[model samples]
Structures are given as C-alpha cells and as structure tokens.
Target: MFLPAVVLGALVLACLVSLGTGAADLGLADLFSGSDDSSRILLVSRVPRTLAAVLAGSGVAVAGSVMQMSMHNRFVSPTTAGTSQFALVGLLAVALLAPATSVMGKMLVASACAVAGSGLLLRLLHLLPARRTPADVTVPLIGLMLGGVVEAGTTFVAWRYDLLQSLGSWTAGDLSRVLAGRYELLWVVAALALALYLAADHLTVAGLGEDAATGLGLSYRLVVDLAVAAAVMTAVSVVVVGTLPFLGLVVPNAASRICGDNLRRALPVVAAGGALLTVVCDVVGRLVHYPYEISVTVIMGVVGAGAFIVIILRGVDRA
Candidate 1:
C-alpha cells in the first residue's frame, strides 16, 4: 500500500513535469493564461506526447512483468528477449510485402511476430535449469544474444529493401514528433495494461512453473493467455513509439524488490514506476541539450542500464 501510493504520486508529478518540460514554451501556469498558441501546443503536442510516454511506459512494464512471471525470470523482456526485434521484423515485412497495409494491419502482423518471438524464448528457457542463481544473468544474456541475431537479420533485410532510414524511426524511440492524431493508437495499450489485473492471480501461480500450477489446478490456458497479452502489448508499444529499451526490465525488477512476489500487489507499482521513469527520462532528454532534443531511447539506455546493473548486483543478488 505504501509503495503503490508513493509510486502513483510520483507518477502524477512526473506526468505534470512532462507536460511542461518540452522545448515549446509551455507550463502548467499556461493553463490559466488562455493563450491560444499555448493551448494549441498543449493539446496538439505536449498532451499527446505525455500520454504516449505514459501509455507506452505502462504497457511495456506490465508486459514485461507478465513475461517474467510467466517464465519465472526477472531479467527477460521484449528488448532483451528479441520480442521487439521480431515485432520490427513483422512491421518491416508488412511494409515491404503489402505496401497497402493499413496501420492496424501492421499492428496485427507485428503482434503475431512478437508472440512467436516470446514463445520461442520461453521454449528455449525451458531447456535451461529453471530459476537457478546463475540463470538470473544467463537468461537475459541468451535472450539478448538471440535478439542481436534477429535484429542483425532485420537490419540486413531492411537495408536490402532500402528501408533502413524508415526502420531507424521505429527502432529509435523518439517522442519529439508525436502529435495528437499520431499517438491515438497508444490508448489501445492503456486498455491492454488494465486487462492485466484480471489475469494477475493466475499468472502469479503459473509463473511458478508447470508442476506448481498443476498442483494448484491453475489452467495452463492462463499461461498462454498471459503470453499473448504480453506479446500484443509489447508489439503495440514498439509499433507506436519505437522500442523503449530496458523500460520493462528495469521497472518490474524495481517493483518486485519493493512489493515482493505478489503480482496483483506489485502491478500498480510497476505501472507507476514505468510511467515515472519514462516521463523523467523524456524530460532529461529535453533539458540535456536545450533547444535541441535527444531521443528518449538514448536517455533510457543510459538510465536503465545503470538501474539494470543495480538490480542485478544489489536487488537480485541480495534477494
């Protein structure tokens, strides 16, 4: 209760800061001035951008938490486990093959690919000892290696098809160009994040592995459902806002450390933490190079990488 309260409050504050922290001259105070340009910018740009950050953040974090719980591994996520790269491949494939494919069509294909990627990673993990101490590190490395291979392949294909520059946009996680209409699809992610609560209890049990779930009479269907939910969430996030590297991994691990093993309990904390981290990272990106902007991916890579190390060294090791 205490942790969730704190995180939610921080998330609200971070969101307010995000709305005002952009390059355009806008602030919460502007809401009182009634300036049309400020109102326009707030509605057209900052509002959309802030919503995008929050939606993408919560979506990816919950997806990551579900994946970790489903597989009983804390370190694996769409970024580390090749799911985002696979989504990228699917999106690229659609762009190249069906030039007439609509945005919704691209999301469907990308989500299917992300599901396959997640399933493949889960199968591979089964071949390893489940939840061993060494596995805490080994699992992510294997997933990252798998992702690297897939990403390299995607890069080659995109280059051959002369879509490398376009690929750069989806892979880079930039929020600078997000306008109102452009980011409306992210609301789908918000809805998906909410659905996690419905399945939280089952996922927590299934995450304990087959024997434990069976002993408790928890249907394996919940496991597959969780996987699909996470995959779709991951795919939608990548398609809309580019891949926010380490967001899923960093936030959930932080939540688990504070909130313990209960999925239902930890989930709110994960969502808020995810939103806060993203909003803060974006604000830092805007301020770090005033007048110019850095990509949120760049900011997150530095910040999340440091947090990832702390989690591995202190959080997991101590646990």
Candidate 2:
C-alpha cells in the first residue's frame, strides 16, 4: 500500500512533467492558462498523450503481472512475446476490412480478435501434454511463433496493397499526433483496468496454480479467461497507441519485488510504476534528439531489454 501510494504519487509528478515539458515548452502556468493555441495544444495534445501513456502503461503492466502469476513464470507478456503482434494484425485487419469504422470501433474489433486469438492459444496449451515448465516461457514461445505467422500474412497483404507505410506508422510508438476526440477511446481500456483491479484477489488465487485455485472453489477457467481479457485490453491499447515495449514486463516485476506478489496490493503499484516508466521514457524521447523525437518503443526496446536480461540472469543465479 505504501509502495503503491508512493509510486502513484511519482506517476502524477511524471505526468505533470510530461505535460509541461515538450516541443512548445509550457510552464506549469501555461498548462493551466494560456492562449487558445497553447490551451488547445496543452489540453488536446499533451493531455491526451500523457493519458495514453498512463493508461497504456497501467494496462500492460497489470496484464503482464496477471499473466506471470497465472502461468507462474516471469518471461511472458504481449511485448516480450508475439501476442502484441497478433493484436497488431487484428488492428490491421480491421483497418483493411472497414476503412469507414471509427477508431473506437476498430479498437473494439481488434481487442476482441486479439483476446480470441490468445484464448485459442490458451485452449491449445490446455490440450497439450501439460509440461512441468512454467507456462510463461512456453506460452510466449508459442505466441512468438503464432505472431510470426500472423505478421507474415500482414506483411504480404500490406505489400500487395501498398499500405505498408501506413501500417508501419501504426506499429511504431508515437504519441505526437494524439488529439482530444481520438484519445478518448482509450478510456475503455481504463474501464477494463478497473475490472482487473476489482478481480485482483481472484486472479492472484488463480495464479497460485489451477489445482490450488480449484481447491479453493474458484473456477479456474473463468479466472484464466479474465486474465486473457486483461492481456487483450493491454494489447489493444498498445495497438491503439502504437507499441510500448518494456512497461508490461518490467513494472509488475518491480512492483512484486517491493509489494510481495499480492495481486490486489500489487496491481496499483504495478500500474503506477508502469506509468512512471512510460512518462520518463517519453520525456527522454523528447529530450534525446531535440525537435526530432525518438519513439518510446525504441528507448524501451534498448534499455528495457537490457534490464530484463539482468533480471533474468539474477533469477537464474538465485535458482
């Protein structure tokens, strides 16, 4: 609780910083009151991008935490594996199939499809011989293979239709173009995060292992479904805002190290940690090249992957 509060406080601070420091260089005063252009850019552009980072960060981090718990492994997440790619495939499919659809409608379709794809993979895992190894590692491996297959299809289609540039733009993490009306759709993901928060206890119990959760009279499959739902929400949010790399896998593990793996207790902490990391990364992205900003995806892919490697090595050494 203390950890989460502190982290969330830091998250708020990071958000304020992100809102204030940007290409336009607005002070705290300007954030509150300024010219119409300043207000529009601050309220419409900066606010939405900040919100997107926070919401997307929270969503991915919580999903990764639940996924790690559910599978009893730390190596799994949409970003680590290929689940995010599959979700991207879903988003591209929607774009190709329904060009007239609203962004919210596209997000819904992509999210549902991603969840279904993940569900299919889960079912297939259940039907397998049930290896004793942690599901996190194995599930991500499977997801990677599945994502490769899906990406191939997406690549072929995009090339065939000359939509590769547009598809590429969507896959890269860039919040520079975020606007008021367009960004509101991500609040649906916020709602989904709230649901996961409410069900945290059940999820933690289920993460103990299927047999234990079953012994406790919780429906194991239902809890698994909920976790998948959370993952889909995370993936869809990423798809909506382009890909964010390390927030999911890194934040939750950090939270658990501080908060003792109690899902109800850790969820908020993980969310805060995620948001903090994302905002910091965004700030760094803006500062790294001045007017030419780098994407958070690249920053995380480089730094976050290094951090992940260190953590994994530490775990291996402890074992």
Candidate 3:
C-alpha cells in the first residue's frame, strides 16, 4: 500500500510537470484559465504526449519484468534482450515492403518480428549451461550480442536503402510530435498491462523454470503467453513512441529491489515507477534544450546507462 501510493503519487506529480513543461507556453494554471489557447495545447499535444509516455513506459517495464521472469535472468529486457531490435526490423521491413500499411498494420508486423526474435532467443537459451555465478552474464550478454548483430544488420540495410533517417526517427523516442490521434495504440498497451496483472500468479510460477512450473502444475504454455505479451508490449511502445532504451530493463530491476520478486506485488510499482521515470526523462529532455527539445532516447540513454552500471556493480557485489 505504502509503496504503490508513493509510486502513484510520484507518477502524478511527474505527469503534471510533464504537461506543463513543453514548449508553446502552457502552464498548469493556464490549463484551467484557458489562457493563450493553453487548454487547446493541453488537449492536442501535452495530454496525448504524457499519456503516451505513461502507457508505453509502464507497458515496456511490465514486459521487461515478464521477460526476466520467463528466462530466469534479471539482466535481460526488451531493449537489452533483442525484442526491440527485432521490432525495429519489423518496422523497417514494413516501411520498405509495404509503405501503404496503416499504423495498426505496422504494429502487427513489428510484433510478429518481435515474437520470432523471442522464439529464437528461447531456443538459444536451451543450448546454454545453467549457472548463476557473480560473473554469469551469459543470458544478457547473449541477448545483447544478438540484438547488436540484428541492429547492425538493420542499420546497414537502412543505410543502403537511404532509410537511415527514417530508421533513426523510429528508433529514437520523441514525444514532441505525439498529437491526439497519433497515440491511441497505447490503449492496447493498457490492455496488455491488465493481462499481465491478471496472469501474475501464473507468471510467478512459470518463472521457477519449465520443469519446476510443470511439476507445480503450471502450464508451460504460460511461458509462451508471457513471451508473446512481452514481445507485443515492446512492439507497441516502439511503434508508437520509438525505442526507449534501458527503460524496461532498469524499471523492473528497481521494482524488484523495492518489493521483492513477486509479480503481484512488484507489477504495480513497476508500472508507476516506469511512468514516472519516463515522464521525468521527457521533462529533462524538454528542459535541457529549452525551445529546441532533446529526444527522450537521449536522456534515457544517459540516465539508464548510469543506472545499468550501478545495477551491475550491485548485482556482482551481492552475488
């Protein structure tokens, strides 16, 4: 109760700050006073952008948590674990092969690629020896290496086709252009969040490894469902707001540290904490350049890298 309250409060505060921090000269007071068309800005831009951040951030965080649990590794996420890279691949593919595709069409394609990527990762994981030593980075290292290879390939192809600029826009998260009609895909993300919450118990059991889960009468199929959910979560967020690097990775880790590994207990905090972190990053991005605006990806990369280092050191020390 206390933790959820704190996270939700922080989220609300961050959202308010986010709503008021953008360009076009809108303030919180202006929202109510309807000064300078601030109310219009609030509806058309600020509100949509903030909501997108919250939904995408929370969705990706939950996906990352599920990814970690299913794979029995704490270091992997949609960003670090090849999910977003494959999503990028799908987006680029759709752009190239089917330029006439709708937003939902692009999402479906990216999601399919993401799901295939996760499947490949699962198959690869089976070939590795199990260990949890302090130096054990087998899972994340492999996932990173996989994502790097795919990302490089995608980059090369995009470069060859002169789609690098377009690719960059798709990969770097920018909410400045997120207007009202552009962000409704996040409602689907909200639904995914609900699915994760409802299935939290099964996710918990499945996290104990397939053999354990099967012995405990948990259907192994839940692992597949978890993978699909994580993949879709990553894809939708990417399709809508671009890839928010290290967001999903670090947010779940923070939630686990605060509330232990239980999904039921940790999911709420993960959602709110992710939303807060993202909105705060967006605010930082907006403030750092003033009227020019920095991308959320830039701010997230800087902050998430620092947090990643801290997490690594802490995990090694504790192990």
- Predicted structure with the largest lDDT when compared to the true one: 3
- Across 1-319, the per-residue lDDT of candidate 3 in tens digits comes to 9989988998998999888887677777777786657878889999999999999999999999888877777888998789999999999999899999999999999999999999988789889886554236898888899999999999999999999999999999999879999999988989988988988988988877668889998888755576688899899999999999898889988888888778999999999988888999999999998988999999999999999999988883323
Instruction: List runs of model 2 lying over 4 Å from the truth.
Output: 127-136, 316-319
Residue 171 Cα positional deviation in candidate 2, in Å, after optimal superposition: 1.2
* Backbone collision tally, model 1: 0
* Residue-level lDDT tens digits of model 2 in 1-319: 5766778788888988898878786887887786897788877789889998887777777778887777666766776556677777777777788878877777777777777766766775676565445423566677667777878888888889888987787778787767777677677677878898899999988877788899999999888778766656766676567878766777777677777768888888887787788888888899899868888888877878888877676662110
Q: What tens-digit string does per-residue lDDT give for candidate 1 at 120-182?
A: 887887898655652377788888998999999999999998999989998999999888888
Q: Name the lDDT value of residue 221 in candidate 2.
A: 82
TM-score of every model?
Answer: 0.94, 0.92, 0.96
Winner by TM-score between candidate 3 and candidate 1: 3
**Least accurate 10 contiguous residues by lDDT in model 3:** 128-137
Candidate RMSDs in Å, in order, are 1.8, 2.2, 1.7
Order of all candidates by TM-score, from best down to worst?
A: 3, 1, 2
Name the runs in model 3 displaced over 4 angstroms.
131-135, 316-319
Please report the TM-score between candidate 3 and the true structure. Answer: 0.96
Better structure of 1 and 2 per TM-score: 1
Q: In model 3, how large is the Cα lDDT of residue 241? A: 95
